[model samples]
Target: MSSVSGLVKTEQLYRSQSGWLQRAFAWCGWENGQVMANIRAGRMLTDYGRYHLSRKQFIFAAIAAALVFYMAAYLFYHSALVSIAAAGFGIIAPRFRRRSLLQQRKERLKLQFKEALFSLTSSLAAGRSLENAFLATLDDLKLLYPDPRTELLLEFQIIRFRLENAEPLEYALRNFADRAGIDEITQFTDALAACKRSGGDLLEVMKRTSAIIGEKLEIEQEIAVMIAQKRFEGRIMMAVPFVFLAFLSLAAPDYMAPLYGGIGYLLLTAALLLLLLCFWAMAKMMRIQM
Candidate 1:
């Protein structure tokens, strides 16, 4: 019953957020165009947590996946038709790529937000109100992140823009926290709002929060460094089989020719599926939710 309700909520969200053009494209089995309508309408903020791949990027991923799948299929069964059919798996590759990209964005934003907090604390110490401090922090962030497109810089600019337009600081902060989907930012917003409401020492709170969050981020980075080596080792282990198969095919074609026949065909297919399952399982395991 819970699963059914979850599915219903998902369905409703899909209908509520998507435009007619996006819906039409999705209904026609074009996954790449699902977010194009929103993009064209300049409503990227509304889809902040979800990464939208450009059409070219989506097509490129699909093509790359198709080529890889074709090669793997050919390695197992030297049939051109089978390899072509296997390449159809590429159509779903962009979906997984989008998920991976979203994760990357989140990680970058987390680090950027940490740096922004450091800047914010410094500005708060200089006798600026929270609103003016945010505006002042932009100059510090610009020096640290010279790239105009840096995630944190863009976020600060948005906040600054909202402040200039007389929007409530809490509303702007909450919007940022919602889009970020980061616990650190959410906690900071909640704390700031509470502090402001209670007329507490906002500067001290900012200093404490920034210090704590920085230390936590440092620990996470250390742990990530340790886990990264293991992830690399696992990738090498996964690549060995493909490398071995390719070497065998090149070094002794006659030896592998039997594997393309009769019962060998069934065996190779099972092995291929098993390998894919293992890859999927490893991917899931490697994603350590922080």
Candidate 2:
């Protein structure tokens, strides 16, 4: 109880120290209304596993999408109107980008969570109680991820705050698992909660749990390494058709001109549709959902 109270006081002091700096930034207009809104959204970002793309991220993605689609369409149909119309596909770019960001965030969380489990398990083996082990894990986490804003570190802050407020470790761990949306973390939490309820040996259960989850993550890392080259090759292959068309148009404009109208236009449309379908299929196939 004394240690927990001390932690709460320390947290309060740290936040109070940072508050004036934040207020100064706000007053100076360095963090204006729009920046403040995004900062609020970013804080809310911790509440869920899904990512919300900010205006800037979405706008940049949309512009890149529009440019790529326009270039491909112009290469296939030499018509300005058709190229501009195709660029409207930019509307869907943010959705795909958000999914990609969410996946990346979750993967990073998975790796960090694995390290956290190791630290927690070590603390338990060293004779700390479960709650103490959690607090001790924070020290290890700080060393492992120097960034103050790293997602797992923020999560530990939340968990520690809950602990300071006298919440049970089980409930805090459950909330973390839910927010994290990671299978390994969820399983570890479940196992932990069950062990606590059943008065099972904490050190033994944690050791086994950590070993199993670490092995799985290591396997995933190996698979990712194996598929990395293939994914790169896939991206290069997708760009080949557009590059070839641009080359032909530059080197032999007359040869490519015949394909810019009438039956050639229809053929190009079919080719573009085929290209899109193939691109979609390749993306779906390459995404390993494990």
17-115 per-residue lDDT for model 2 (tens digits)? 889776753332233456548677764536456666666777788789999889988998888999999999876677778777888888898889989
Scanning candidate 1 in windows of ten residues, the lowest lDDT window is 25-34
**Model 2 regions more than 4 Å off:** 1-45
List candidate 1 stretches off by more than 4 Å.
1-41
Clash count, predicted structure 1: 0
TM-score of each: 0.86, 0.84
- In candidate 1, position 196 carries an lDDT of 94
Clashing residue pair totals per candidate (backbone < 3 A)? 0, 0
Clashing pairs in 2: none
